[model samples]
Target: MSLEQSSIRDAAIKAPGRRSPAANAPSLESLVSTARALVPRLRERGQQTEIERRVSEETNQLFHRAGFFRLMQPARYGGYEYGFTALLDVISEIGRGCTSSAWACSLGTIHQWLLGLFPAQAQDDVWGKNPRAIMCGSYSPITAAEAVDGGYLIRGKWRFASNVDNSPWAVLGVQLPEENGAGFLLAPRCDWSIEDDWHVAGQAGTGSKTVVIDKPTFVPGHRKLTFAEAASGAPPGAAVNPNPLYSIPFLSAIPVCLVAPLLGTAQGAIDAFVELCENRVTRGGIGGAGARLGQFAHVQSRLADAAAAVDAARLVLDRDITDVELTAAQGRRVSVETRIRNRRGHAYAAKLSHSAVQALFSCVGGSSLALDQPVQRMWRDANAIAQHITLNWDAVSTMVGQHMLGLEPKGAY
Candidate 1:
């Protein structure tokens, strides 16, 4: 390692979650409760959020001003330095009201934690000028990076760069196979352009449009972290950040960010459907218009099953988060066994949430096909979440199952 890199990794300081935020900064409870309070307003805006095919700028400003984006940001950067637990609580509540808004906010907060894994120079390049600057990324390795003097020259198109409209920087996946590495290269906003082409049947509000870097762009060496380094549980950023949260293995816990929204949206859909049951009635059949939907034994059964599924999913997620936090606090490397186990938990929780949303959406009868209903939108968003590569059940399940059976598991964690 270069002297500069060694010095960067050796100098450390003390900072913990207990360290209070800047005077008057919102507390963890305040952030979460604020999220709960925003539910009604988000619900009111859900249809419009969907119609716009992106999170409205008004809603984005609400999060920024509320400090919702600082949940996992490093304390030194004028942030709250809260935990994954805090992240889960806040994002899920937002998801309960509107999946798109919740999703956009979730990525925004989690990436702060992710960026804290980079070298200090990279962190400074981003937050020094504007601490509130947010980052979006596309981690599907479709790009080529040619080695250059200072760092690399990259040119490619990346898709599903979520919340690009709100981000000033992006970290894209690049292959460095010659070095046996898979890298995330950070690009300034000026280096890339957005393509407004995120139209989809579900998750229309995510605005996960394409990010294009048609011309070669130079990325400094500091603005990169390979997947291997991220999984180390002690990347370069750990030296400076000093928070135990930075010690946790990357893949072991970050998936929680992706799944928490699913859990919240499922719970929210359940809430919506239960209210619908209280007044909804059958029509044009033997039961006639007077038949109360809630009184039907089949409907009751579906509701019960779905509620149980959601609860089980939450328990799994909570258990894994606790394990990750404990491991980090103890300053121990998360075992391969634990990493795969957490991977299983993340994927299984998503499966359960998606299943629950489908059941409730089905219970709505013709309402299932209706776009105006929140339950239908929740179902669609849940499906979209399930489709994400990081949350894919078939792949994750098989990989974990292989490890459980004493076989060679491959890809992801």
Candidate 2:
């Protein structure tokens, strides 16, 4: 028998038919409120988080205790199984305070939701010991794997694994040699090593460093999640978990996740700019010395444009989220046409957000260039997030255009 098939048999032999407890659902409103309350702490820690190139351990624990990690987890595993939109709401709230904090929090918890789409055995493997276990990942398939007795022995280095230091489990993307396709393997913290390589101008606090697997690490079959399965939103665990929340296509859902932080970061930039304009008097400019920057017609026009752009992005995001949720609840697969539309919307939202942040940053003048300025930080973070491959406007726009022209869209989305 093939090694993959044998691994499946072995897992079946030891499969634990665990039953989850009754749902302890948390209201979305309460979660949003809790997230909003943490903005002050998040903002206070922003500089420190950036200096350390990671969210503080204290802040990580605080978020854990607040049940933020359980927002999308399975009910049996102590997760609230909140709707998909709940993540956007909470992440955006925290993001208004600090983009990196929101990025780490959002990525970490979203992995919990991703775990819900794995086989029940994989779910039980991680959550059995600690239901609130946080997960980190680098989903690009840069690793090499060899078929072994019961699984694959994988060796490679994965970069851009955000929040790796704060996580006990990682989902490493791999290229399946035999199948000539991609899959993700779940590895415990002990199987891999972390390399401190996250150095960047924006979102530096994300601690998105390299996760190295130098030795051949064994990954069992039950722990493997195929790209095709994830893209289809019909993972094995969905059959057992029976939740519509897990049914959303991974690509459609993930593009939105990438844009959520950018949305909030843009809003943060706007808020900071508005406050500065209200209080700071320009030394000399078109508005003249001793005049509040807010009083200038130029400033007013730019602010209005930025505000409108931000509002438009949020509206687009909200509409996509609602559509995905309704489609999932109806137990219908998201059509390729809809997925393409979502990809376009997600990337366009980032474009709008980046434009808004840039507009506000331009008027903030030389003082905004200071590292300590919140508006500048927001500007940097917004641009950085927009550059992410998932949300890059040019790439996504081309993909949508390709689909519209009856050409196979390039890339996984």
Cα RMSD for predicted model 2: 9.5
Clashing pairs in 2: none
The RMSD of every model to the true structure, in order and in angstroms, is: 7.6, 9.5
The TM-score measured for candidate 1 stands at: 0.93
lDDT of 2 by residue, 129-157 (tens): 98878889999897777888878999889
How many pairs of residues collide in model 2? 0
In order, the Cα lDDT scores of the candidates are 0.84, 0.83
lDDT of 1 by residue, 154-250 (tens): 9989999888898999989999645767879899899999999998878788778889999888899899888888999889899888888887888
Residue 320 in candidate 1, Cα distance off native in Å: 0.6
